[model samples]
Target: MNQKPVNLFNTFQLGNLHLPHRVIMAPMTRSRTAQPGDIPTDLMAKYYAQRASAGLIITEATQISQQGKGYSFTPGIHTPKHIDGWRKVTKAVHQAGGRIFLQLWHVGRMSHESFHANGQPVAPSAIQPDARVWIADGNSAGQMLDCPTPRELAINEIKAIINDFRQGAANAIAAGFDGVEIHGANGYLIDQFLRRTSNKRTDIYGGDIPNRVRFLEEVVETVVAEVGKERTGIRLAPYITQRGMNDPEAIDAILYAARKLDRMGIAYIHLVEADWDDAPVIPESFRRDLRDSFSGAIIVAGNYTAAKGEAIIDADLADLVAYGRWFLANPDLPYRLQHDLELNEMKERATLFGGDAEGYTDYPDCQEKAS
Candidate 1:
């Protein structure tokens, strides 16, 4: 006889948290943080609180330090003001009955010179990525600016950044966050270190696969030490080739790192798959390999619909599904998915970044629309 099928709406035990369902809100950088200090605002708090029904909400990429910043208007977790700002957000989410995780970020070479005081971004190596980051003009309007060649980080700087990750985790806890997710994907600082195309160093943190993964390993170890392995998760992108991130050995390196993370007993590994219309599909073998390597929970995100999400969970390839754009427009996404309700389309594409409540908190839920 066949056993019962697992539903996406069923409860899941992710590490120390008991999630009500398997629908997660994937992290999306809206670049809407308060200006001057890159602090979270009441508007951001309202936006997160409005979507508290998700099983879990991974906040938009938050810089762990001023040097970690790349895009304009994105929030940070380094300063006292940032912690206080985030406290409001976490309090609002908890009151609304939602669990949230802060994604610690450092863009590395995916940054422009404007964000740095010395006019140089830091990375594992000096290789320049063919990427553009949003830089706000004096008028508060932003435009994509090309990233300049970054200066390679010294040995001491690498250790400092690791400590920064540790401090970021501690700060998140102080701000009442349930957990923290290290942004190790999408050609960021960590990703640059993990890829050969970006890292050309000869030190202990470069060269072979083991050396290439050393930086990430150190960062994870430090973060886990600060906030236990159970409250730590990481996001990795293996199939992404854009933004000068076409590393042929990325999969092997990621798998190697996954095995190490499994030994450390981290809570979960969130995979950011290619989501473009013609993007190459992640093969089934890789999924099985990833599951085998990491015994803990796995969350997959990339334009996944309700049916596709259920299928992956049913197949035991992934434990949770994260929706980015869908949750952006549908504050009541889980309810709508469970009840087959219509999702609201994004009203203005321009309002997606660096804007106010028009596309941020103005999206109505099903009940609100009905009433």
Candidate 2:
């Protein structure tokens, strides 16, 4: 370990990316996109562009297709307008000197029936997890609606989703993203397939670890084909057991997937650890195992302070530490951390989702607060 002061402000390189610092802005779903079509807005661009000092900015989880969506007001990368909307965001971020990656997402069984065409969500199996999805209209505030039993996807449908992912990556590139990230974490579609609790399939897409990981492999393969391996990344949460997804098999499957991604030469593998107070502790031994498995850059995100993030970097556990809520509230997060400045608190809880610029872009930068 090259241990000459490993800290958050240290410069780092991720493939062709030469980051000025190690602090990365974690992807968070604020649900503030333009309504009806769920397109990215200029305000969203300003919001992202404000935090351009981070090493990289992973955009909020974006649906690849209408069927892939589980929540309202979350942006999409499937349509021309969506691409145009995101183009503005990318340009803003780039102009402000920031590198960003678009996160491709599909909700699977973690969706409500209202978002589906056949009055049912889609999953690896027909089982309904004890979870709820965020649903909102143009009227009142959003509420969590119970996720219903989903229809198991046919093998052919699975291939079509692979195509959807490929197209989504291409669209992300078109939208001027520096790279693309596949959302395989947080009990979503890919996580559902990787875990045993939700995926009880008899076909080739289930049973053993290899079979269950077929969907993720194919998706990564198609995405790599579309946008090259160097520009592709993935996020995985081996520890999360939310929404009835408490599968012990995920540990091995995720490890296997990490090594496979390394073999495929994917740019990075983002590991999402637990965030809440009662969240289970991820052992340092597993972190070492993961580091040995994947050669690419690793980013660990959860609830983390500067000291905690620095300690991980010094211990050679992760290359970068991502901050979610802190970055959301502080536009000049990197500056604040760099100078040990007092942080601003998040003010608009009611308008965090599906709102105007009031809560989204109105958060002041560090200099403004100091002034």
Candidate 3:
């Protein structure tokens, strides 16, 4: 067996910040927040800064508007209070010497009317997906329910939504984020437009691949303008096998987008290469295409181990590898990697979502320390 290099400890650059390693803490939705709105609490700050050992931290998807919401207790970046809350979070992470980025998101048709502030869900087209979203009631805890048909966004509405993302990027900077990441992945709003199955419109926002990607292109341009191009990144799930989200020959679309983003000088592109089981296998051709297209960093995620991550970096497939479940359970993940320590088991899925601090902050680090 080949021994891994201790120089994994070498520093790297992510936009304006220097990282201590190449292990990234991928953004994950814990769905733990206060009621009425998704506000970051002091405990949430500690939870993030505790995991600061990561080379870089990409925050959980934060909705840019009320209509951008999908699940209950998910954070947002639309209001002053939200920015203030995130201000505390970014300060804590920076104090711990961690560089973080805020992921700007809009769920679009993935959300139900009840989740929207005006009780009206919005999307590219007025289509309802055969999906369910979680809703929180003051009396009852929460429940997974059906989604409703969304209001088709007019051309003007589409422009406004782009502006909203620009504002979200500004808010992220005000909150002290090192950068802003555009969430164009999963089955969310941006992905909804990218995939032909979800986006069925004759307008400029939909039709062929370029038209379908118009929303994402505009968003990238808008955000890059708000925050410098060097400080902007994008998360795209161009080949997700889960949730029935996929486009024919998805790699072509991804490469096209990556090349386009490269011309814009974006910081990095995060590709979620996971199957329904959350296992990852990047096709050789796809990996090469990504490496050739994007001159910047490429971060791959979904069930990647320390050894596997090192293999990817060695293969020149990606600059960094993000660990989802592993980082969640082990706050000192980078230390564990350096010392070749065993990782803690993942928390029970039954208690993963919509909790205060039970599974949120209760996960033990590599060693026990005084609170």
**Best by the lDDT measure:** 1
Candidate 3 segments exceeding 4 Å error: 1-8, 117-119, 278-281, 369-371
- Cα RMSD for candidate 3? 2.1
> On a 0 to 100 scale, what is the lDDT of residue 66 in model 1?
85
Better candidate number, 2 or 3, judged by TM-score: 2
Tell me how many clashing residue pairs each candidate has. Answer: 0, 0, 0
* Residues 1-371, model 3: lDDT tens digits: 15544545667787777888888899998877766678988988988999988899999999998868888889999999999999999999989989899999998888877666667788887777778887767743678888888888899989999999999999999999999989998888888888777777898888877888788889999999889998999998866744435568456666777888999999999988764565446678888888889999988887776677777787778888887878888898888888887777877775567777777787887677334
lDDT of 2: 0.89
Q: Per-residue lDDT for 53-92 in model 1, tens only?
A: 9999999999999899999999999999999999999999
* Model 2: per-residue Cα lDDT over 234-290, one tens digit each: 999989988888998888999999888999999889989998899988998889999
TM-score of each: 0.98, 0.97, 0.94
Q: Global lDDT of each model?
A: 0.94, 0.89, 0.83
Off by over 4 Å in 1: 1-6
Give the C-alpha lDDT of model 1: 0.94
Query: 1 or 2: which has the higher lDDT?
Result: 1
Q: Which has the better lDDT: candidate 1, or candidate 3?
A: 1
At residue 282, candidate 3 shows an lDDT of 65
Model 2 CA deviation exceeding 4 Å by range = 1-6
- Candidate 1's TM-score reads 0.98
